[model samples]
Target chain A: MCGIAGLFLKNRALEPELGAMTAAMLSVLTSRGPDSAGFAVYGQAMPGFLKISLRGAENFDFGAMAAALDVDVSVHDDHAVIAVPLEREARVRALLVQRFPEVAVVASGARMELFKGVGQPDEVSKRFGLVGMTGSHAIGHTRMATESAVTIAGAHPFSTGADQCLVHNGSLSNHNDIRRKLIKEGMRFETQNDTEVAAGFLSWQLREGAKLDEALGAALDTLDGFYTFVVGTETGFGVLRDPVACKPAVMAETDDYVAFGSEYRAMADLPGIADAHLFEPEPARVYFWERAA
Target chain B: MRVAAAPVAVNEPVVFDLAAAGLRALNAALAGLTATTNQTVWRVKNPRGEHAIAVGVTAPVCIFVDGPVGYYCAGMNDGADITIMGNAGPGVAENMMSGFVRVTGDASQAAGASAHGGLLVIEGNASARCGISMKGVDIVVKGFVGHMSAFMAQSGNLVVLGDAGEALGDSLYEARIFVRGRVASLGADCEERPMTDEAAAILAGLLRRADARAEVGDFKVYGSARKLYNFHVDHAGHY
Candidate 1:
């Protein structure tokens, strides 16, 4: 068992509180998954630049590495964010690969930055000041380590694509088979996490031009397990459950925001929750929400 | 106006806030009022997706929960009228002996499974396995019901106003299934039978008790074929 929570602000006025609200929601779900925690936040995009969030091993010099890469960087405790030209991101990643092999680049997109760690959710949130950061939307996870051992790499909100990440609440029974199939198709495995396989599947689908809803709808047929997934992308978010819906998932939508949680208590503290339209996501159905461009 | 559950009772309904008082305190208070039939009402605030909200109730009291609940809320209730203003998780009012459990919003799987007596009403959709293995209770759903509903049902009636999901009433027995909307598919040993006047009256009476206004004429009834009822050597394959 695990916990997945996500929030998308319908009104831009609430964007500044995205991290705080999502932190509160994730905090409530700590009881569901106490092994590890993580979150991804989508901030305002700067034209022509991509924000790369990375975590490195002990004693890795993030400042010098940012200087060497010729990008402006913001350093947190152990995580750092670097803003580089979108056209040069490939070059930047290749450079990191050659020089900073010990560093792991988790997520990179113009609008998003991801952070994760192996610890209690509340402490991790405080470590990164998750309650103070602001963004347009965000998703979080508290992992119980049912599918894989408890490690920082096995934590949830696995990012396998640019600006795309996913958090899962149930174990994937067929992941080993599917992971082998995906690995044969050129997707690299970062850890033994089944959620990474799902993230890879969606990333591959999205790379193949499938929309978020279409990719999620296809997942309903292809992925077999008692699972509930909340996915975050560059411009939108999507939610899906297994055909049987053995995992618990509830969603609340108000005029200002849309929130997803494993249980209602995780979302009870959100704004306008008392009047929100709350319902459990149906089995094999994709519930996708997006910002109107 | 979203919080109101009174029927001219003299007692100022006891209020318990789950966030403050906790589940044991709220449940003990409700259990404390089991001996009296003084038309008492209890208002619960901030339920926060807790399970077994009013489980194993044996007295005639009124309960109003203001928030959503987790699994088995109101399970095994008897002689109480419970109303949840928000959604309910799996097995809401499951194995109910007697009472009226009303959900103003949707319900998760197994809305009223194996209920012996009572009326379970859902104003919104009910997910998979709604009323599975029902014994004698009556279930009324105003919106859609998900797949495999009323599975292995032995007795009682399941009424749905909207569409039903795949394999509804699979392996059904004795329990009457009435769906006003489309039936996706029937389970093994289940078939659609014509609604007789007697079945119509039963449907009408259940609808009245549930406070639903849909015409019984709009419903299509389904039930067991009785093919699996008696053991026979030649029909062994059907079993």
Candidate 2:
């Protein structure tokens, strides 16, 4: 199992201290998932397009591809960091669909910066400015590969073509069936990781006009297995645990913000968290954290 | 050597005084001793499910818990030797990095969950999901274990001297499970594998270490079939 943590601050920009808070939260959970670490910070000044991070199997030349579509691309050790211009985001996405269809673009952002790498939390945090950014909310994952290969691309917060990203902690038993259905529906896949398939499935639901909560609820019904997931969008964050509630998820909410993680140790670092009540989320519960509008 | 079994004195300042004094006495006995040389004796007259009564001691202190204990009675223990005279609650030695935890009575769920390194011996039955997600902990239970025991177990040796419940070793990887009794069912991709000589030796060693009389040859080994490690269309039903 991996460790996933996020903070959602409503109606306010996350304090600069949030970077330290998030880093501290992720630090206590390094043992839960030690293979790789990554985080996504969503702020008001962020862009509206998806920021797809690609890693492993570095045969594709992202610069040429980006140049072809007038999209900006940065490469880092098997990772293809692409920032699609807001106006031509659709065109760039179409270009990606046409090229390098086998690469998993795990996680995206507008003002949300995402960075992941293979190693300890401190290593990943240092490699990708995960420690010094502020936003309304942020989600991070540390992976211990059980089913998938241990690589940066296989690391989570998987993103679709839209502004949606997800971090998962449990196995999706019916991932192949869901992957087949999605493939039949013209959805392409990049990684052999089941989590990518889950991300695609949720993105498909959202594109089909399902609300974030409804889409996740539908996933809870159709996807069979023990899973705890946290999804981040441009505007809000959401968390869901599987029906049997086999996986652990503890969440505490005050009037100002909500913090959740696979274990209480991760959230123990949050400020103003007095008398934080910790309990397992009931089976099949879908919680949404929006701007509270 | 005979410690009388009695209920923990609750709401009484005298018993509290005695318990505190007992701890101090044990600490004094354990002073300037190594984990191997000490073998200190603790006579817990009334151990009514108290959490963390004797924990985190590195010396080879021998604690004879005269009665049952609550959650994490000897959790995160390193080097000290604990022998519970009665049952123990969930996570008896959770995340124990080293040392030994021996429960003479039954153990609750997650008996040794996430113990990175240690030797845990449960002489009685273990509840559901025992040894879930352990990392390098070695557990030997002389009785049955409930369903999903050793789920997603990364690295460990879980030996069940009696029957095992459904889905034993579900999604299991690397961890080895040896059971002497019937298995109710196997979880997704978990199957009974032929016992190898190394596994037999390991089982024999664990049984001998726990002082269990059970024969090693009578035990069957179960592990992940490795079918669900990657997604496949043919094995969709197992999911």
- Which candidate gets the maximum lDDT versus the true structure? 1
Best by the TM-score measure = 1
Model 2 Cα lDDT, one tens digit per residue, A8-77:
8753644565667777777766877988887776744534455556553546666776677676676654
The DockQ of predicted model 1 stands at: 0.58
**Tens digits of per-residue lDDT for model 1, A1-293:** 78889998889899889888988988888988898999999988889999999998766688999999999998776889999998898999999999988888888887889999988899889987898888888999998988788999999798988889999988887888888998888888888878898999998889889999999987887887878999999889999988878788888999998999988889878888888988888888898998853
Candidate 2 CA-lDDT value? 0.74
Candidate 2's TM-score reads 0.56
**Candidate 2 docking: what grade?**
incorrect
TM-score of chain B of each: 0.92, 0.81
Global local distance difference test of model 1: 0.88
Angstrom error of the Cα, residue A271, model 1: value is 1.4
Give per-residue lDDT, candidate 2, residue A244: 52
Looking at model 2 chain B, which ten-residue stretch has the lowest summed lDDT?
B9-18
Report the Cα lDDT for residue A91, model 2: 73
lDDT string for model 2 (B1-239, tens) is 11223232432211222244454443334344465542355556555345565666666656666666656777777777778876676678888888888998777678898888889999888877889999999999888887788999989899998888778898998889898899988887788899999888988888888899988878889877887678898868866
Residue-by-residue lDDT tens digits, candidate 1, B47-123: 98887898887888889998788889999998899999889988999999998999999999889988999999999
